[model samples]
Target: MVRILRGLAHKYFSDEEAVILFLLLVTGTIFVIWFGAMLAPAIASLIVAFILQGLVSKLNRMGVPQTVAVISVFLVFMGVLIGFIFGLLPLIWTQVSTLAGEAPRIIRELQSYLSLLPQEYPHLVSEEAVNLIYAEISAEVGHATQWLVSFSLSSIPDLVALLIYMVLVPILVFFFLKDRELIVNSIGRLLPPQRPMMVRIWHEVNLQCANYVRGKAVEILIVGGTTYVAFKLLGMPYAALLSLLVGLSVVIPYIGAAVVTVPVAVIGLFAFGWSSQFIWIMVVYGIIQALDGNVLVPVLFSEVNNLHPVVIIVAVLFFGGIWGLWGVFFAIPLATMLKAVFAAWPVQEDIPAPAQEA
Candidate 1:
């Protein structure tokens, strides 16, 4: 046992640098997991700073002064952030309230429709089965409504936390964006001086993350704006809300589009039943989704996320299981970073080859 343990240690930890890297990684992961709630604001600020870095670089490359560029980009970010909060938040809240208010009516309508199923298809769907399904659905809807009402009423503390985040996050983001170099150098100082492997991994992560974030931002704007316009033209209620869902759905790749489709279809059906308007709206929505997946995504992300579909799904599921929404958003980049680490890691090429049959 001792001999096996020693061999394993020699195999993995022969290089002091590798040992240090492994330890640092373990420590960082543990720290983030342990204090994630307390550190949410800091982590959020870091992500925002990372995203804004692209604009700062663009302005700099246009021969703008660093300070001027930073201020310019920061101002633009603040403008959009404020606009979203003021313009979209109220509309979304109103629509959500509308949906909650209509939930009982929707349930009644659903039950009425289900009641016809037994007469229409007596063999396939028995009256007993219809009653059982209706009861289950009614119970679920009742629970959801109760939860929603409680959550809305109890949001004061949550609002307070949000206010605190709103105050602190921008301040942190501004400093991080302004002092990008100094901050990088400061973090660099904490690591070993001779870390080419780490540096390489950092470069890959930085490049991929920047490209992804920028592309996603553009994607959200283009897709959301287009959806809003289309829904408006179709005279759809809750246009802004549905558009927002469609836009953010890009974040989860395959899963988000499918999930949001349910609400869109349900709302549309309830509004127009099986009428031509609903059919037309659905047709338009399908077109938008198709163009987005086939055209817009390819143009914007173009080789940025070269991960396979299965890998993307697994990453989404794995990270989402761990960190909820933010984890879902960052899953692909984090997984890609892991891929980079494994690729950059110095492996033992001198492992004894399997002996020939003797």
Candidate 2:
């Protein structure tokens, strides 16, 4: 068996297709190992928090004292959280309550409309089909509501865990910030002596990760603020909550903005009776999204990790399948790390230099 494995490895490494297959197998194995490990999620979250702390440390290098910088960043985060709770929570609660009160009337109106459709086109469809559709819709909505309730109940444990994690994150971040250089050097020391290039690759990867995290935080704040202000000016209900959702959703990459926008628009349409007010809500979301994608992201996050859109989509889907929301949250970071690893392989090309005089 050993001799056969050796022969296969030799043959595989000699051919391009075989080499690609081998790499894929290795990557899959690594992913499985990482996922199966008990500490993976905690470690990933801690690393992310540490990266944010390091950003604060960088500010300290620019003349801000360490204590002041940490306090300032923490205060800013708290202020934003407080503002969101005060400005958005009540409005959302009110709107949601109003919508709930109106749901039966809306359903009756929908049924009436569906009934009219068959009379208007008697030969085209049957009343039973229309009834079936309505029944299905009702059933789906009921299930959705039940799921939401269950989700809220289940979230209590997760919320407790999150609070614990939050406490640990600050402690970890403090140590990370204080001994950043030592950590890097220790990681480098773990690599084999023959692989000096690994150290340089690690440095590059760290830099890319740092830039991505810092830029993303800035992008989230800008986009969230823009959304909140736009919704407020347009007299949209739950403006702050919707904006906060949109902003937090931005961390998921391609689909996050859409997830927040579509629900908000649907709720607006239902609440406002599909009038011009609903249209304005859509327009507000569009403007916020356009600015976020074209301006804020490009300007702030341009130099961060550069993964292909396809890879990001796959990672989002894959991780989201495994861990739900938290998976979605960390998808891009994991993809970034994978991209860095792939780029570090010898087969990847370096940037070409311009032709020089002899």
Candidate 3:
């Protein structure tokens, strides 16, 4: 069996294309196995939180101690959460209540608009069909809102877990930062002397993962802030809530901006009667998209990850279909990790000098 495995590895690596295919297969299999295990989501969330805490460690190097930095970062995040809940929640609750109260009127308007269509079209869509559609849509909206509320309520346990994690994270991060060199040396000792190539690959993967996480955090903040400010200035209802949605949705990549814009525009139109405010909402979203596409994405997330956009879209759809919100949230990070694995095989390239030297 050992001899047969060795022969197969020799044959597989002899052909470059075959080697690539073999690597892809191995990566996919590993992902499936890991993802299928019930612990994948929790593991992914931990990795995310670790990355954020690692950033706090970097900030600590600028002056603060790890414990103080971690506390400071957590406090800042908490302040933002409190501000959002207090400032935005009331406005959103009021607007949502108003929208609910006007639901019957909106239904009437929709019916009137639908009635104007040709009889042939109307025949294609029966009264029962329209009612079913409305009922399904309304039910879905209610379910989504309920899920959000329930998720918030459910977070109490998660918060307790987080507090526990927070205490552990800083201790972990401090040692990680201080002993990073020792960790590298320890890993090197585990590998065979001839496998410096594997060490290089590991280093590359670490850099990619770190950059991707940091870039994403920055991108989300900028986009979310822009959306919030734009809506607030235009006096759009639920500006903060919509901005949060937009910011959070961006984790899903291209579809996120559009997903956020549709509901915001629809609600604005309904609440403000398709007037200047509605138009301004459309304009704001358009500008936001333009900035994200042209400036923000290019500046923050220029790494190609070697996956086609089509592959990304499909991953988002498939994972999102199964795991819902968490799937969408982690899709890009997982994809990026997969890309790093693919790029890990030995390749000769020059290392660029630091920008200061350049």
Candidate 4:
């Protein structure tokens, strides 16, 4: 057993550097899995800093001083964060409160509409089934509404957490941006400098992740902004919430748009019924989605993240199960990293070239 283990280790690890890399990966995975929720703020800060680093680099390339670029980028990030908190939060809260307050009425209206189903379709739509569905929906809606009310009213914990994040994330991001090289070098010092596998993985994963992240952020903003404008022009209710959903939906490839579409269509139906406004909204929405899928995605995303749809879905399911939303958000990047690691992983399939009996 000992010999077998050593042979396997030699086949895989082969060297102290490889062993150290393996250990670091295992340790990091364990740390993230165990303490991810506890360190959410720091994790969030790191991600934000990473995203902002690109902009800082761009400014630096344009002859701006490092300090000046960092400050400018940090200020822009802070502005957006603060604006979302103060400006958008109140608006979203108002809309959400209004929606929650009207839930029972909406349910009652839906029940009324369903009542006509028997006359509309006597064979298929039975009154008994409608009653059963209505009862189930009412119960679920009641629980959901109660939960929303309780969550909104009991905001102490949430508010405190938000306060902490607001204070800590910006500070962490500022330092991270300013001391970017220093921080990277500090971490880089721990790893063995001679590991070609590690170097290859880092270079490949770093390029893919940087491009994917920056492009995704741009995609989200563009999709979200375009959606907001369209919704606002169409006089759609809950424009901010719906647009935010549409924007964020772009993050999850192939599934997000479909999922968010149900909500958009439902809300539009409730607001406009079978009116021309609803038709126009659907048309415009379709155009936006078509443009996004066909034009924007191709233009924004480089060929670096040419992952298979199945791989992406599997990664989303795996990481999302472990880390929830953040996992889902970083699913593609993590999957790409995994692919890079595997590609660079040493194998023991060397066959002795054509043994010739001399």
Candidate 5:
């Protein structure tokens, strides 16, 4: 066992650079896990700056001055941020509150529908099962309603933190972009002068993560905006809320769409039960999802290597468990980064045994 352990270590960690890289990774993971909440604003700023860096680089490559590029990108970012905060957030919040207010009514309607399920599918569904399911749903809805009320009452502290983030993130992002090279060089100075393994891993991670994150952002906007327009044109209630959910659903690949579909279908049924409008809404939704998967994804992620569906789902569950919503959002990128790391990781090739005389 001792010999085997030593052999494995020597095979995997033979390179000094590999050992240094491993230590760095472990240290970074520990730092994030321990202090993630306290340093959320800085981390968020770093992410935003990382995303915006591509645009800054593009502008610089076009012969624009570095300062001009930074300012231009920052202004556009601020514009979008303002619009999201003032324009979209209010609409979504209103819909959410409205939905909460009508939860009891919706629950009653759902209960009524489920009560009929046992009769309609007597062999498949039992009355007792239907009753139990309704009980669970009612309990969940009650909990959700209570949470909304409590959250509203206790949101002042959260709002203050949000405001702090709003102020600090843009400022930090601006400085990070403006001094991008300086920051890179400063960190580079802390590392060994010769670090081919780390360099390779960094490049691979950057290519995979940067492209994915940017593509996802664009995809979310397109999907969400399209969904909102479709829902509104179809006269669907809670268009903004449903659209936002639909947009964010893309982050979780298969599961999100499936989960969000339940609400969309329930709302449509409640609004236009057994009607052509409900049918049309479902049709439009299906079309949007089809186009997103078949068209938009191909265009946006043309350069990206797609992870397997199972891997993606597992990543979503694992990372989401660890970091909540942010984990879910970045699950794919994080998984891809891990894949890249392993692919680029240095390992000693096994030695071949000398052939015996034939």
Candidate 6:
């Protein structure tokens, strides 16, 4: 065991830079795990700043002054933020409340539909089975209602924190964008003067993950907006809410789409009742999803490394288990960054055991 441990340490940590990098990774992981919630506003601001930095750079390259570029990008960001909070959020919330109010009716209709299964397919489904299924669904719905009530009752503190974040995040994002150089340089001063491994990791991660992450943000907006417009045109109830789900469903690669389909189907069935309108809604939604996967993804992420489906799924599950929604959102980038780190990591070639004496 000691030999194994020693060999592993020697192989992985033989270099000073590798040791420093390892410590930094460990420290960062510990900090995020322990204090991430408390620093959520700052983290959110950092992400917003990072995403907007590309625009600022583009404007600067186009001969705009740095301060002017910063102000322009920040203004656009605030406008979008304000519009989303004041306009979109209320609409979604209203739909959500309406949906909740209609749940019991939907459940009753579902139960009535299910009760016919045994009559239509007596050999396949028994009456007892239908009753059991209905009971299970009712229980689940009851639990969901209880959870919603509890969540609402317990959300006062969270609402305050959200308001605080609204006030602080934009301010932090503006400064982060404007003082990015100062911040980067200050951080650089703390690191070792020579850091080839770190530099290599950063270069690869930036080349691959930055574009991928930014592309995803754009993809989300496009997919969500397109879905909202399509659903509205189709006269789908809860258009905004369903479209938002459909848009966010892009984040988890294969799984999110499949999972979110259930609600869309359920709502569609209840609204249009297996008629031509329901068929049209499903067809349009499917086309949107297909276009997003086949067309938008390739164009947006042409430069990104195509991780295998299994690897992406594993990454989503692992990181999501660790950090919940944020982990899920950054799963691909984090996985890509780890891949870069592993590629650039310094390791001593294993030394063969000494030859045994005759």
Candidate 1 global Cα RMSD: 2.7
Better of 2 and 6 by lDDT: 6
Give candidate 4 regions above 4 Å deviation.
Answer: 1-18, 113-133, 344-349, 352-358
Q: Each candidate's TM vs. the true structure?
A: 0.90, 0.72, 0.68, 0.89, 0.96, 0.92
Off by over 4 Å in 6: 1-7, 122-129, 146-153, 352-358
Q: Which whole-number lDDT from 0 to 100 does residue 309 have in model 5?
A: 94
Count clashing residue pairs in model 1. 0
- Runs off by more than 4 Å, candidate 5: 352-358
Give the clashing pairs for model 5: none
Model 4 alpha-carbon miss at residue 109, Å: 3.0
Summarize candidate 4's per-residue lDDT along 28-123 as a digit string, tens digits: 999999998899899988988988988998998999999999999998998998899889878887887787787877787788888999989999
Worst 10 residues of 2 by lDDT: 344-353
lDDT of 3 by residue, 54-120 (tens): 5686787899876677666656655665675678667776766666656667666665655545455
Per-model tally of clashing residue pairs: 0, 0, 0, 0, 0, 0
Q: Report, for every candidate in turn, its global Cα lDDT versus the true structure.
A: 0.86, 0.70, 0.68, 0.86, 0.91, 0.90
Residue lDDT tens for model 6, 1-358: 9999989999999889889989999999899989998898999899889889989999999999999999999999999999999999999988887877787999999998998899999999999999999999889888877766677778889888899999999999999999999999999999999988888878887777777778888999999999999999999999999989988888778888999999999999999997999999999989999999999999999988878899899999899999998899878878887887787788898868999999
Top model number, TM-score: 5
Pairs with steric clashes in candidate 2: none
- Among all windows of 10 consecutive residues in model 1, the one with the lowest summed lDDT is 344-353
Off by over 4 Å in 3: 1-8, 11-50, 53-129, 142-194, 303-306, 321-323, 346-358
- Model 2, 179-274: lDDT tens digits are 666887896565445543455556666767777777777878788888888888878766766777888888887778767766686567656766
